[model samples]
Target: MKRTWIKKSLLVILLVGILFVLAGTVYLKMNTYAPSEAALAVAKTGKSEDQILFFEGEQGKPAIIFYQGALVEKESYSLWAQEVAKAGYPVYLVATPLNLPVLQQNAAEAIIAEHQLTAVVMGGHSLGGVMSSRFVSSHLDHAIKGVFFLASYPDEKGSLENFSGSVLSITGDRDGVLNQEAYQEAQRFLPDQTVYEVIAGGNHAGFGSYGEQKGDQSATITNEEQQTQISQLLIRWLENLE
Candidate 1:
């Protein structure tokens, strides 16, 4: 009877593992947003290959490296990067492994090194933002000047409470995926000069090109409107870093 029970337990574990794999596959397929013409167009402004969208600006100028949110295609945040690049600095929309930023924590390092970006700022949307904060904190010796978050905040695991550089935190008022308690608490971890902006009537998915995200409130603004607002905000903040 003991042997029989052991076999049954193993079988149950196998079934559960298979179920989890299937769920993950489905989730990834459903969430990966395709790059649009506008996004490609922006990429063409510099280079579009190797899963890295580059909007080239003045050489040696500071660059902004962006991380992709969980299960989100890297191109989803191209709109913001494009706008920043137009403002002067090259913007890199880093493609993380398995579309998860946490899995590729040091991905930004390679981009910054290979591109010869002297001064850099890191940013992202949602989980991307959280991971970017973690990267900057761990690599404090690197020349990263600051961090930006869209519809996201750093948790204790990636807290920036003692970070000395500039930080920008932008969120949509209607963001349902963002934890209200955590975001409010994150203020304590950021520097006093952190720039926080709340986009009126915006939602979590508004920061990316992906379709409506599950558990997120519907946005009162169109995707273009929301993205444009974020773009302008990023432009102003990054330019100030000059």
Candidate 2:
């Protein structure tokens, strides 16, 4: 009877653990920020396969591999990626597991190998940026020509202080969700030539068209205006990289 009771207790514990895991997975899936109709319309121009959306551009130009922000749908960045592709670089918008880039930090490697891309620029929004930076830091041999961050900063472990590539960091002046303290502290991790830009009245959510993010301040500028500014900056930066 004692052995039977112990076995039953173990079974109950296993069942509870499985339930906890399922609940967490369901919560993450439900809490994800879905792309707006406008974003979806723009995304239609790109071709998607499995977890990657490809925006074609001119031949011989370095490709851009972008990672989406945590809990934000990958399609939320379609408009921005489309604009970049128009400027002459192919864009691969990668969808991470559970909308979390941290789960696949080395995703760019397979893309580089598959496309036979000799040169590449990697970037991401928010937490996606941090993970991208981590990948770039560790894979310096992958021909990464530059790194960009949208309302994001690299963690100390992903420091690029010694990187010889171009770096661009963009954020909104009214971004309430960004950790100002951490942003300032992370500056030492970026290279000396890093170009920093701030949109005057823009907020955190201006970087993507996924509606207002939780805990983010409202933006004074329209999403269109902010995205246009960001697109222009990205184009100019990519041009300079060549």
Candidate 3:
């Protein structure tokens, strides 16, 4: 009986050791399987590498998922995302590899599941913001923390209804590319709660990482200043919300 007891104890110890090894191997494998290629392929639906950029942060603040403008790539938004991460908020870029409309929604749901986020605040640059706004309006029951837009229109893609969520719109005062007509039109949807900020000398591409590629030739603010101001504004707004 004593020998049998010893054998069972050894067997249990061996099983536990094997389980630990298996768990460690799975973790290592998952860490090695990055989705850069899958993300790039999704970006090709309209543009490559336009969907998501991941950044490490303080892990308590809600994740900030950025959706880029129609023609911009995901890498172009990394500068702003990195700045947000530095401020202690995790950030991810939302892409549209399969399709902009579908992928953005899918990305949000998938990220929420992966991170176990009960309430995530979503935003984007230009059309990306538009997409996020539309999404949050419909998914408000999911406990979205807030919604923001960088040089993005407020209305839905095909309709006149205002986007759902705590809307924030930022644009450069000197940005001729972001038509004021559209801005005003979008405002009609959010009567009192929307926060619209216009940075002096900023441009339509203020949220992007690169400025020379846009070829507007009229921007008054340096890219660094624009990026900083944008990041600060986002952080302030995020800190104030419920």
lDDT of 1 at 18: 100
Model 3 Cα lDDT, one tens digit per residue, 99-140 = 244345546777777768875888877767777776676665
lDDT of 2 by residue, 128-200 (tens): 9999999999999879999999999999879999899999999999899999999999999999999999998
lDDT of 1 by residue, 1-242 (tens): 99999999999999999999999888887767665566555555667667687777677677889888788777777777777777787888888767888888888888878877779989988889989988888888898888999988887767787788889999999899999988888777687889989999899988987677888999999888998999998888877877
Report every candidate's CA lDDT. Answer: 0.83, 0.93, 0.67
Best by TM-score: 2
Q: Give Cα distance to truth, residue 118, candidate 1, Å.
A: 1.4
lDDT for predicted candidate 1 compared with the true structure: 0.83
Q: Model 2 segments beyond 4 Å from truth?
A: none
TM-score of every prediction relative to native = 0.86, 0.97, 0.71
Clashes of each: 1, 0, 9
- Pull out the clashing pairs in model 2: none
Candidate 3 TM-score versus the reference = 0.71
Worst 10 residues of 3 by lDDT: 31-40
